[model samples]
Target: MNNLLTGLKNILGVGLKPGSYLNILYLLLAFPLGIFYFVYLITGFSIGLGLLYIFIGLPFLLLTMFSWRLFARFEGLQARWLLKENVEHDSPARWSEASGFWNWITSRLSSKYTWKGLVYLLLKAPLGVVSFIVTITLASVSGVLIIAPFIYKFVDYELPWGAISTMPQALSLTAFGLVLGLLSLHIFNGLAAVFRWLSRNLLNSGQRLAVAE
Candidate 1:
């Protein structure tokens, strides 16, 4: 697992920072809010503005912002971490003396890189949606083959291709099923590889953002 993650950092165009493993690091922060977002959507909690703001609206927006900054910092950090470079990040030593919420927020705002990183994080959801749909589609076709015999009962007998009105025989179906099941693994692995590459590029903006910084 460490080697795979490390390879991701060092791979061409990935350019993750050594200590910045920020992408993996900050994923935890966004997790709980994600759960809440799903629940809120399911419950249809849009009637009350105040409640919606606190529960549904606010968490979603904040998570979006949080995900963005966190991942950007991750990308930047991963780059530094992998390359073993000590890029200068804004020093926060003096902020320990001053004690105010507004002051801390101001200090964070001063570093524009964080905001830049945040923008990158916001893009993650859309890329994720595409990745999910493609992967799920390929995997679902494979799953249908795996359970071909059982599928006859569950799936309505209308052929989408309009090729056959009646269901296929169990023996032939099983043969095709076996072939599909085996081939599906190869296809899934290939699709996963493509998606993982896309994710590294889309989510880990370490190389480009680092140069921009």
Candidate 2:
């Protein structure tokens, strides 16, 4: 746990600029892909539902298994644009646009990257849920703390979170707000850490260029 905390700290401490925010923004545009992936999984998993499109469904779903490189490409672009880290991406490998369907599937199946990419895709949902919860909780907590003191003397406003039993009608309430702010920062550190480690493992898997001739 201590090591994990330290790693989180290290990742959060990395100098990030406005571009880093844009890197995250890049994900917003990929929402369509995310939705497609979700549907792909749902349909693929349904025994009777996906039989009609089995060929495309199974292959496309499997192809998503290799999308980690696609995800990493964005990360690499971010690294270069945000942190001046110019990671190389060999032009081509197992994925061949012109190859026959069977060749395409076989090529991806045989490569380590296909597996890695698939793994990354699999983890996305869980990480997204965690991140959403942490971010929202932190923001809400901080907001309550920050705003509570302003109306402490007023009648009463029951916070949705019944935790603030005592109306924040005092200076201490402001202190609580500060704590929430710091706590949010702490969680952000964790998010950044996990994201970095995941990116490294999934995106940086192929050290050698396997560009097909």
Best by lDDT: 2
Cα lDDT computed for each candidate against the true fold: 0.44, 0.54
lDDT comparing candidate 2 with the true structure: 0.54
Q: What residue runs in model 1 are displaced by over 4 Å at the alpha carbon? A: 1-94, 97-107, 110-113, 151-168, 171-213
* Model 2, position 33: C-alpha lDDT score: 46
For all candidates, the clash counts are 17, 2
Among residues 3 or more apart in sequence or in different chains, the pairs in candidate 2 whose N, CA or C atoms overlap within 3 Å are 65-118, 152-169
Tens digit of per-residue lDDT, candidate 2, span 138-163: 66777766777566556354556543
Scanning candidate 1 in windows of ten residues, the lowest lDDT window is: 204-213
